[model samples]
Target chain A: MSAATADPGNGTILRAHRVTKAFGGLVAVKEVDLEIPPTSIVSLIGPNGAGKTTFFNVIAGILDPTSGHVEFRGDRMIARPIRTWFEPVVWVTPSVVAGVISVLVYLATANADATALAVLAAIGLLIVMFLAAIVRPRWYLRLLATAGVFRSSRPNDMVKAGMGRTFQNIRLFANMTALENVQVGMHTKMRANAADALLSTPRARAEEKASQARAREFLGIVGLRGRAGELAKNLPYGDQRRLELARALASEPTLLLLDEPTAGMNPRETAQMTQLIDRLRRDLGISILLIEHDMKVVMGISDRIYVLDHGELISQGSPDAVRADPRVIEAYLGKPAS
Target chain B: MRPDIVRVLQPIVIIAVSLVVVWLLLGGTQQFMNFLTLGAIYALIALGYTMVYGIIELINFAHGDLFMFGAFVAMWILTVPLGMTGAVDNPLQLTVILVVVMLPTMIVMGLLGTFIERFAYRPLRHAPRLAPLITAIGVSFILQNVIYSVFGPSPVNVPQVFPLTRFEFLGGRVSFLSLFMVAIAVFLMVLLQLFVGRTRLGRAMRSTAQDREAAELMGVDINQTIAITFFIAAALAGAGGTIQGLYFGSVQFNLGFFVGLKAFTAAVLGGIGNTTGAALGGFVIAFIEVFATQLGYSRWSEVAVFTVLILVLVFRPSGILGQQLGERA
Candidate 1:
């Protein structure tokens, strides 16, 4: 199932090294390490407020870690804040020093034209700094990245690098039709740009037709065979969940992160979703990282499980091993009667 | 009446009333033609305000000045570069010259818009909303000052390349210039609608507007999409500016201030985030202004426009075509 991608030397598809996220004074995810092997289902399970979602966010590049780094298939996805220290020194220091000198010279010499000249130079330097920070030319990024001093990855970057994700609370474009939602998910795969679209070129029209067909096929896979024309907001709760899964699949991601995919479904729907999840790994050969509160689904489908309690990884192993571990039991069911 | 019935009849009733008023006040095709031409220009400029606001939820106070700058660009191309001071009678020659002037002006203004967005607004994207707004006003002032220093405060004469050929239509006068202006505006607007509705980048834009994080997770390059939005909006404003110079025969540094206010008013009236709404709002505003001036309240026209704006805000807050509550998450 995992034969589609070249082996990354290591067996894992994703690796997080001591990732920590702090929101002001509160630490949400603390020094958590995780790995997802090729074409495997890995579950992160714990009681509510155990930092599972925060850890999920850190891995998906939605939130930056307070420290440490994440790697995907041997490529660095994110790194620590080395640039925060290095940028000001290289970009801002000269401008500030020039500004200060200009002020001092204006007071000491009382020559307005000279002061203006100095101010203009300072402004020019500041413009250069602004361009550097905003434009972020490839050479500058490569130079810093090679030195292990800077690495930045936005969520789009992660998606382009073969990662796809769904939210705990569904985030569909409510006004868009179901088919359009799926087509938008295939944004990275499309090639027609503004010019082609404006002119209605043959290639653009052909791509549009192809994507519509592909989008409908995805909808059918999720058991939504004919609901593609309905607005996403108009779908029932169960169908919306399925539609979200269909959208995530449209990205052709090598690794998929499902944040509580069956969070609000009934028993029958949950069973269906669980089967779908299993079939996804078996058929599509994509690794999945899941956060689940339902113990039955986790224990039934996960190849491995990690337990988190109060932002700490308490135990990790095969699902049966985790179910038998005392630390996992203590985290979920409290200490034994004494 | 039932709510559904009221919803169905409301627009029809408003249209009937507006037609009666326009017929009684304007009373002539000449004045109506003026309304259409003015409406077209306003619609083009209003789109810039509506689109930028839709994508980023930024008011973009500097957009009006970008239109003014565009007018200056056209002026420079026509007067300084091409050395044409007056209208060319050859229709073929005029058409060619118009194309020559418009393309560069629009492209230059479009690039300038992207530059401003990259420099001024992108840095404050994550800052509090008010920060980018202030930066927009600051950009507006800088644009005004730059134009003033170079061109001076007086209104500069522009070549009205579009000939004022008049013909009688139903007991009133119609100018070829008016027809040309309206045709161009409608054509560009249709092109814009097709692009936004059918293009890949356009879908990315709509998704980003709905949920930025979700769109990013779908692999939409958020920054590039935003820059493109600014480019298209500014380019449309540039076209509007070119039309203004050709129609009115003059350009000024302060030209954008009042016209921008009216175009902004149009956007708010039609619905700030909806493109069709902005275009509709522009024409409706032109009708009201034309009616007011024709009825001998020319001095009070601005007062009338603002009064209507305040009323619309007070009553419907969401303008005519704004999204319903259920559409928003």
Candidate 2:
């Protein structure tokens, strides 16, 4: 855990140390260490079934690592703040006790006057349990979690923590308008509750207006300004890909993860996407971690690349160095035909 | 005209034409007012159904039961605690009682909705769609029996606490209570439209409905958004229940069962996922029911509503305002 925060001056924005993920008996991602420095584009390249997506899933908090840790901006992704045992006790013990007491009272009262008292007591106990859960000290909570009250960070938490991603396939909200899709990405940034929404309070209204303006700005950034009102499903293939990128950017992420951004694009669309990726790095000044199948895109854009083979990082270096490595070549193309 | 502008105006024109035709057929304003009041109540309930379906695609069979419980809650508050078994003559006292009863009922029902989602629907989120549908029916029965056990099977007569003052407009007499209910319903509908169109959480809801995975990737908390949707929908249902109690002066344990089905029909009629459409569908169904009853088909009103639902499914499956089949957004 201390290693997670060891280097503040190194400019590394994300660090995954010995990260491993397993599904049942199958080890999908072996112990892998990787780092993405600030304002740099790092590509993770591999052949099919190389576990790139699994690795992405782990870091993105979509899947929890069986072992090892992922730290983003010096914060661990999975935290066991309380002992595991404490959580159950805090959550369940009062209810069990109340149930027992209620049954005893009911029996003692012969279903009479005391039944009300028993109900009141049970409600009181439940309230106390809720209060304890909400007001307990962090250290005490962590101690309880250690006894098995574990809570894992989720993908939305990662997004709120300044990480954003797009899927391998275009996962844009197909039924939503392009502008609305981007507005959804701004969920964490906006602050309005149900009451505010129902009452149409001034603050909620102002926040809504600001979010719409920002959503439109994001659309413009993605070069889909005029198509903001168009449904995402109606967008062309290339436009849909860019719309996904726009939606991701609306989260105001410091680190962007793009998975196969150009998977189905033609040569012209692919080149255009490549340029947009370069511009994202240059203009936005945000660090990017990309998982791509196309070697040309990787070689042309990646400042540093990591090559995976059989769920293991076989090589890591600059584009030219990784391309020149015999192991990487063999991993991608296999042994020479002769 | 551009297609988008035409799309927006088409529904307005259709509704206007229908209203004019109904006006001429009814030959009187009183009947239309009655239909409007009933339509408002149905619209309120339909909004709940449409909202929950939009976000999670769950029918929430317990919703009608929630509305029933809301009526029961209001009844208890008025009869047992507030001691308002008869109509209050003082406007200020009436206002206070309405606020006291309505606010707590909405809150409690909203919380119950959240609880139902957490326990019943959330677990089956990833299961086959039919699984939740069955669970929803099960929940509906549980709620119905719970109410039956507590309140008995007899209809509880709700005291008409609302003022019965009538106002004459354009040779039509409209009760203040009816007008009030319609106004409240319209207010809520407008707020809902603005929220979904403009607010951040509303955007999250629409996105989640369209694509749950994509919404999560964009930092939208799918669970929280769904929970909020349930809360809002149930709260609206609660409001509708209160109005129903005041309007009809009686509530039965099975009140939700019939109303819930009607609301579901309304949702489908207005396009299940479209918010404003559900409201329109509710009013449309109300008009159909009222007209049928007036035309000496009182026994067949329910049949008529169902027939309309089937017709919509067969000819225009998307309902009146539904987008084209492949363009459901």
Candidate 3:
């Protein structure tokens, strides 16, 4: 089912420019540049400890790069610019203003009561600030951004912005039912607020029904419809993987990230997973970024491949070209006896 | 029966049997009425403990103090602005007053709870578990001291606004006020259960509690969900505080110390992360407390409660209806 026609947007869907992630003194990923085109399967392959997962995490917004940035569909999703350094100060603006006001009042009025009033006003403003942070009115967020105090995108932000991902270790909501798992993935799409749910309003009820139906459809797409009622942890290994995919798909992301989708699967299961991945992209027009250890699966499905070695991107090309590259071979298997 | 069925049924059966035993021990409707009211209050507080633990895994020691704040807020609302120091003869007027007072108290406490999570817990969310745990204790002390300073270290009387009405029921006199308190408490608990079990946001909360990272990946806002959890939990504590004042007729600044510990014990007894378990734990702890006092062991009531807690911990560390088996990760 690899008959998917290229979409209108020929521009890159995801672009990472010299992304690097460091853990304290240890650099996990270094200056990695990658891109995924619309309706294409791109694979990132590397040996253990080569930072493939770290790169995946940076793309997924699970971690911010020590330097560099990532753009999703032309929107910067991850970055640590100079302005971000002012975020903490922005949060403490109320206290600073309060302190300045009280001090100024004491200096100008020379009256203790005036200073006390100023202090009280400060407390009131602090409360307002706290509430503003919680409610996060759009204007406030815009003001923060304009003041260069914006935060990097969180995982939820990435998911809401049409990116979905699964973990290499299969991090499903294990205690929840498979159906509930998918429903949770549809969290962004559900429009009901807390009040609607608490009151069981008609809008909330209708939205819930619609969401459940759609979630079930996603489960069917992943071939886990019959097991919707079963707890996620109770599912078989292959089924759990499929359920995770279903959960990811429930968000209806334009781009999907699969970390070792067929990690522990037998050959037959591996073939089926590869076919499923192909079908997902072909039928739904969703771009896929895969991190795989299996060579045959990667070569068969990926339109383009980027190989990593020791936290650095070593090679990038079409499957056959990348396979033949000497650097990729050296990265995969240490340089042969000189 | 299938194991799943047994797993589901076991908790219900245990709660039922324990309730029956407690009922048998009460011996009089008056004692039973007291038990129900007290149990309802404990249940409300325990829910806050269990939910915070469920989502962020913090034993918010300050929660009990929040309950104390709730009572004080309600008391201030009643006496200061409303100037209500006696019961209203008209039921309609009384209810209007109750709603006016209770609604504001709940909202105030809810916002306070959200604020606490923001300043106290949210920053330490990624810190070592011990850091937040210690912060919680520190927050608890802060709340207690604030209340102590404001309310003064004395027991203030709340208006007995429900009126003195009693009737014969099951060979003992039952007060109308106690019954009303129980009904309201049970109603809130049921509302909470439905909210958590059926709502989309509730699903987000549960998924978040189970796996915060996965839930975030599914677009569940962790901070918002946790803040809501804190809000709801503290709101219930507010309700409990109001009930405690109205029933007991007086409120003290440190009233939450014993109540909070007892409620925490209940949450652990019922299963720390499970909502139903926490509520069940509340009623069970109430039963044990009432039984001790009823049998003339009021001095040993704390001992009885802790002994039961220890025993439950020793054998079934997951609590009475623990969901540990499902948490294989």
Candidate 4:
């Protein structure tokens, strides 16, 4: 990256430098460098087996590069802190439960089960104890995860970080409603737990209501608001794709990765998605990295394009430049096409 | 169309039908009702197995042993002079004491789970499915052996603190102790489901369970989320263990071995990862025993339970309530 062009002072939030991966004999990703500056659209174009997924895997920490570094938001997502205190409540509380178990045992055995009726009576009491779990304390003691706690927040919290994604095959939480599906995508933004849900806390109710509103807004953005309550998998193919996008944007991610966003859509849906990708950049200032096979979709929406062949960056330039490159033509067509 | 009905009525129908059949065939309504509590208790342990497997897809073979550990921890306290029984005589005091005592055992075993995952499961995370599973068996062995070392091979009495009484009502016998077991077990299962389904860690769990790599890319820390999951599930097991120990008034070195196997069957029977399914699976297993015993096959009750498991696996393969989506190894 030119110090003058892709300046760190500017808003380049993600960076990968000469990243490479090899699997013993086969080189998966070979010295690929990428800079995803803020508020811009970039497309990584390659045919199948171009190692695009592997490259994606490396930056995302799903795979460690044999050589190179990945930095997100100026910090390594995998960086480990030396030390910190967590679980303030873990030990203090457990000892108490242990003490109580002991006492309960003492009393039960002190006189107990002179008859089968006694055993039956104990069983009855057990049910009552189970019922007691419904009680959600106003202050349910929560410990920071030894590894990651705020990190431990539900998938619904995805929205708070403004982050979301779509699977190549569209893996929506199948059991959830279209509305609930988007709501789960926004799970990170919610502030409630099972206790609150079970107890029906006013705050929980309000959060649930707010989540519904947010879900509706996101669905409407992708023209699926009407299908908000439907089963996601039950939707038409194109609609499911749109709903996936809507769900992703619901998190308001600063950068969105669309994996094969146009894979199964028709020309109409593809055209619609192209416009939506552009509108997202213009309207929300949200940057996006689209993985697409359709050259039309990639050329139509990408501000800049990078072509990959066998995990190596073969070309990077304006769409017109990429289209005219001999290597790019060969990578796609397997020969220079007239 | 009827999420509520399906969610609520389905379990009720299965449970009610089983309950009625057990009552009618067990040769006594009172006897079946009494056994219902046993189902509830086993349901508690099964819930632990199911919940843990639901998120991480690990059977936690040592979980049954964790329950055994809980009983011993409580027994250690019960045998002491300042035990809960002596300290708290009233109902409310007894309640407070119970929570206090059970809390430690749960935490200790929960940590034990975290350790198991960190030391055993973590290294083998990306290995073949059998790797972590085999480690779990190793853990089970280690825990049992440890128990043998500490408590001896013979059965140690599980001391009880709560005043328990068995009484007759309208030609039916009722065990207050059994009811307590039911209450505690149910409380744990419901509480856990809520935690997993609604909480942040729970969401992370679902996401990781779905696609761990994708989840981590979404800025989810899979390791931390998994550790938390193990902790919560083990804590639940600890509760079950302590309760069972105290209820039976005896825990041997091998207490968890048979029960663990039964609970695993229950986990599979109800649905591997479904929380409600686990609880349901537990009750189903208990009732199976009741009916088998009535038919003079009490000695083969274990065989009967596994037989149902084999049939279910051979047919549905997803258990009664599990989904194929989550069936991946």
Candidate 5:
């Protein structure tokens, strides 16, 4: 289904220029200038202490960049905070402000000044909205802090925009079937309102049926139609990995960030996953920013490779060129056998 | 009975023989049927607890209280000028219409269950399991007192007083009240069974019950699915409450106490997380209690129920349908 997957956007879709991340005293990633052009397979390969996962975490919005801002399609990405209680109170602030302003105008002009009052009310509402646009997030952040959820919104929310990720260790629902796993990834796109679902009306039923069909379709795309009915945990290790990819694809993302997709796979499974990744980039229309420890898999699929040694990119180039580079070989093959 | 029929009718035969013995002891058929009817009612409430536990892996201690609220609300509605009492010749028609009218109220209780899961259970979702369970107990206490404060402690008589009419048998009187209660409870239970077994929400619930994260990854909103489970349990309890009030003819603020424990025990007996098992568990407990009572052991009926529960749990921790099912990815 990812066939002819032309880049949906023109020009560099995501540009991370001079991004650095520090953790108190230690620098986790330093001066990482990168251009992630749309719809291309790009591999981030490195040794154990390479900070590849850390870099992926930062880009996926799990971690904030210590310095550099991420610009995607020219629009600055905003990291939205997870849900909190104070959100409801934050929502009504605009309406409350509008009410106060409208009342003040009414008291000043009396009922005869209809046109002026309307315009004043409209302007007041607009101002409240603008203020809300600025303040709601602040309110949410404050609430999250108070709620002890932990956030440094600047780097976090910024990272989340247009970026999604999967954990290194498989975190599949042990009891949920394979199909349901993929369904959860499409959560943000669900059109059915909560009220409609509870009501169980014909419209809601129709929407739900359609969603189920779509969920089945995604599972099939990953060649997991046979395992769809089985619980994810029950699937063999390789199938579980495939299930994770299916789930990732369900997000319908522009950039697919894979964290060790073939970490525990045998050669056959690794080869299959590599092909899937290549097909994903070519057909699914997603720019692959991948982290794989297996050099063979990396070299087999990577169009361009970036090698990191100690929290910094040591070398980067086309696969054959990077592989031939003495510096890249020194980083991995160890001082050229002394 | 033929050998094939005997194999199929084993439990029924045992119960039939037990009924005959009870008839001899109680001096008749009407009393035996009364016991049977009461068992059916408890089974209804027990079924709710089982269904909920089966899906979300929650004990839902407050379910019994939700049922109690159902009875109270139904009583309030019936007592008001809105419900008519006089033209109640057909108890089936009257009771059916009454319970049917109570659906919205039951649905409201379901919403309340959803709220409990959100404000109470959601925060404790990541914390230790014991945390939310304690929260559930706290909620139950709050609801009981809330009822006492609003409606008072007195037994509120349900105004649509359908007179008890016993259908006389070889030895006793099977009242219209008992018949009506048994009929409605059984019908609703079957209806609920069909709804849960065959529906999409039911599948979502089963999935959530399995593994919440996996379910969430599948686009099943964990919170939404949990809420739906709560709603279903709450609605079931509400329906049970309405039935209890109609059957017993009064609803007390403390009605949930006994019913809640019984339902819990029923859930345990049926297997905590098995929906069909919970319903069957309820009936079994009721039958055991009814038989114990007939044997001049009425005072120890609750003890017998607990003993049976403990015995079952010792053997099968997952309960009757403990199939180690899931919802995670």
Candidate 6:
């Protein structure tokens, strides 16, 4: 049966068509179809162990789906059955070459014949490997991967593609100051090489100053203006949650995925967080995909709500329609005990 | 006073007290100077261990071996290619040889470090923690054996290029070599601190160390950041190795094994992920060793060092400067 889809006219920023994620014997997410429209807030609500997190993990590039696909702005972010042989070659060739050189050097040293030449040869091989890996010329990587290497896009790639996310449990850089955490979030945007960093070059310093200014601005946007100097770990629970939001925003994403952003928060904090979520979309003009447990928060802010049960979407509609659906209620309350 | 201020000053106070005690026991500034110089060497090596551990939580048993490789690289530059044997009387020539040897040696060792991480450590990054750690031990063995085979399992005498002049200070003589070594080590350490504290990549490193998954979510390339960490740490260790060879006037295949363990202890002692702590720990370890030797307990120096390590671990697992892992809300 064809899934009842969201309005495609509103400009779908993110779409997952029949996405499934399995862990050996357990199918954590099965044939889940979702659509997130631009400049809109959509919520995904499910019972405990209903595969909400697993689905989130798949779209965020943390876990690859067993089948199906995830797209952002019509560009595929994750897909099933990755091209296999190339990845192993990309990861393994250097080691194999190094091992060969090691053995050769060992033999040459033992024989004491042209030891200098052997050592030089090993160094040469190592330099070639270094250059190849660093340059990662796509054609070269692909040519070497003739054996079917499984290549998966990393989380950083997703961020560069204008997707940012927060975790279910707050995962701030505990040791870093709030300002630095946000600066790290701006990592992809900053352009400075190692040499620039070592020499403290003018260009690198200018970039650093710019990034730091932007980081502080992000912190200010999240109502954490003066807390930049505090270590993230030392922040209170509400502030820590806000810091995570600022950090995510630092990446300057077009679409933001917030996983249980209000978990463990008091009612007042939860309300504040809900308002912040709304502000993020309205002010920033970014699409939001939210996975939240607080029904009130989700119902109050989300333009659309999708309810999942046992890894499948049981109901999808506006907040009031989803709230009134019999299937959604049954999924949450076990069919009203017959 | 605020607790933060107390926390920052506590180590300094402890170190100062320890210095006073050492001075009283040794009754000379010369031994104290020697202790500081040796401490600087350990600190350089310890920074490597602490940095890798801070980011990836790997002990990097191969680090000391990398330092040993650095020593050999320095030796090869001087003895084989440059062919400067014994003492170098020409100041300009000595300075030129040092510059030539050190730059290439650090670069080679840095590349070697990057190579080790790419080949030896990167593949096993997602494996069980113990797996990469065991691989680190294996890498250590491989490096040692490689050195042993090439250098014939014996101590290769390094030429003493620095002038043997001594500076008199407060009725005590301090060797110029010791002063130069200490200056270089301090300079590198300061550069490292700045790199880790102020730079963008440095911020990425600290974030990665704190939370790898979260760092990635923020668009930090975890693999690249980790690889860079390994490179920097390995490069520093390489520099330390070169200095070590120059200081003692000898190099050995197994030199890194004992020093590696000691550096690991220093890393642990200083709070594994804390850079300043590692440097402090290195200095502390050196002081203890020198003090033990001066007190005629030279045979028990290793025992004493280990004992302090155990005491620190038992009392403060987070270390002197280390924050308790995951302690914040």
Scored by lDDT, the top model is 3
lDDT of 4 by residue, B54-108 (tens): 6677778888888777677767766663344332347786676677668887777
Decide which is better by DockQ, 1 or 2: 2
Per-candidate DockQ values are 0.44, 0.51, 0.66, 0.07, 0.20, 0.57
* Estimated TM-score for each candidate: 0.87, 0.88, 0.90, 0.79, 0.75, 0.88
Tens digits of per-residue lDDT, candidate 5, A188-215, equal: 4555543454556688678667767888
Candidates in descending TM-score order: 3, 6, 2, 1, 4, 5
Please report, as a residue range, the 10-residue window in candidate 5 chain B with the lowest summed lDDT.
B213-222
Error of 4 at A48 (Å): 3.4
Candidate 3 docking band: medium
- State in Å the error of residue A151, model 2: 3.0
lDDT of 6 by residue, A3-81 (tens): 1123345468888889998999999899999988889999999888889999998888777778898776766654322
Q: Per-residue CA lDDT of candidate 2, range A1-338, in tens?
A: 11122335667888889988888998888998999998899999999999999999887877768999887887777733234345546656667778788888888768856777777777877656544443333343454545555554556767877888888888777777888888888888887876687777999889888888898999988899999989888999999999989988988888899999999899999999999988999999999999986778889889999988888898999999999999999998899888
Better of 1 and 4 by lDDT: 1
Candidate 5 stretches with Cα past 4 Å from truth are A1-35, A63-85, A91-167, A171-216, A225-234, A325-327, B1-58, B81-87, B90-100, B160-208, B217-219, B325-329
Poorest 10 consecutive residues by lDDT, candidate 4 chain B: B80-89
Fnat per model, in the order shown = 0.69, 0.79, 0.82, 0.05, 0.30, 0.81
What interface RMSD does candidate 6 have?
A: 2.6
lDDT of 3 by residue, B1-329 (tens): 69999998997897688667777889778788889999999999999999999988899999999999999999999999999978898999998998988889998999999988987888888899999999999999999999999889999999989878788887888888898889999899999988888789899889988888778888898888888899999999999999999999999989999999999999999999999889889988998888899999999989999999899989998998868412534
Query: Model-by-model lDDT, in order?
Result: 0.85, 0.82, 0.87, 0.69, 0.69, 0.83
Which of the two, 3 or 5, has more lDDT?
3
**How displaced is residue A61 in candidate 1, in Å?**
2.2
lDDT for each residue of candidate 2 in B1-329, tens digit (9 for 90 to 100): 69989999998898789877877665667888788888888898998988888778888888888889888988888888887877787888887888898889888787778778867998799899999999999998998898899999999988888777788876778887787778878887888888777777777787777777777777777777887788788888888898899889999999998998898899889988888889999998998898998898999999999999899999988878776212333
Docking quality category of candidate 1 according to DockQ thresholds: acceptable
Candidate 1 residue B310 Cα shift, in angstroms, is 0.2
Sort by DockQ, best first: 3, 6, 2, 1, 5, 4
Residues B103-169 of candidate 5: C-alpha lDDT, one tens digit per residue:
7768667767776776787787778778877887888888888889989989887765666555666
